[model samples]
Target: MMVSYVLVMVIIIKGYGKRIGEYIDEECRREIEKKWERWEEKKRREEEEGVREEMELWREESRRRIGEMKERMEEGIRRRIREKIREKKEEIEKIEGRLELEEEEIGEIELEEEGIEEKLRI
Candidate 1:
């Protein structure tokens, strides 16, 4: 009788084991798919965040380059203005020197005329 009972239980387990295994396999596949979807979503969010950070860094670099260019341009203009001022000062000095030379020549001519007139009177 015990042998018969064991044989009956073995038959029952064999009948149901394949169906249980199939059910368990389907459940495991669904769980793995769910986990994969979550992982993909997380990776996409991380990539988007990285892109945002890259864009921000690019903007900052552009702003810094623009500021540097503006400063260099301003410095160049200042240097040019200083050079022009120096050139103008040099021109003014040359004109003043020429005027002094002309005055001295005119004074010498006047003295020579006076001396000739005195000699004629003697």
Candidate 2:
């Protein structure tokens, strides 16, 4: 009877030890899963931040290019306007020169006619 009691007690102790070991293993698994989840969350946040930074950089580049293009277009327009004004000024000068020459010829003709009239009166 004593031997039987001892055997039963040994079996109960072994069962209790197995239960404890299993609980420890389950707790370890849960802890590892929690750590993995935290790591995944951190990685995801970093990726999102990187993507946001890239987008902002691209936006800035695009804005800069647009500004440069606008400036170039404005400069070209100003240059064209200046060229047109210069051409118009040159044309005006040419017209004024021709008018001056015609006036000088008219004055010469008037003097010749006055001389001819004086001779006729004499």
TM-score of each: 0.71, 0.69
Name model 1 segments beyond 4 Å from true: 1-12, 110-122
The residue-by-residue lDDT of candidate 1 on 22-107, one tens digit each, is 99999999999999999999999999999999999999999999999999999999999999999999999999999999999999
The models' CA-based lDDT, in order, is: 0.97, 0.96
User: With candidate 2 superimposed using the best TM-score fit, by how many Å does residue 111's alpha carbon deviate from the native?
Assistant: 3.3
Which candidate comes out best when scored by lDDT? 1
Cα error, candidate 1, residue 115 (Å): 6.5
- RMSD of every candidate to native, in Å, equals 3.4, 3.8
TM-score of 1: 0.71
List model 2 lDDT by residue over 1-122, tens digit each. 99999999999889898998899999999999999999999999999999999999999999999999999999999999999999999999999999899899888888988999998999
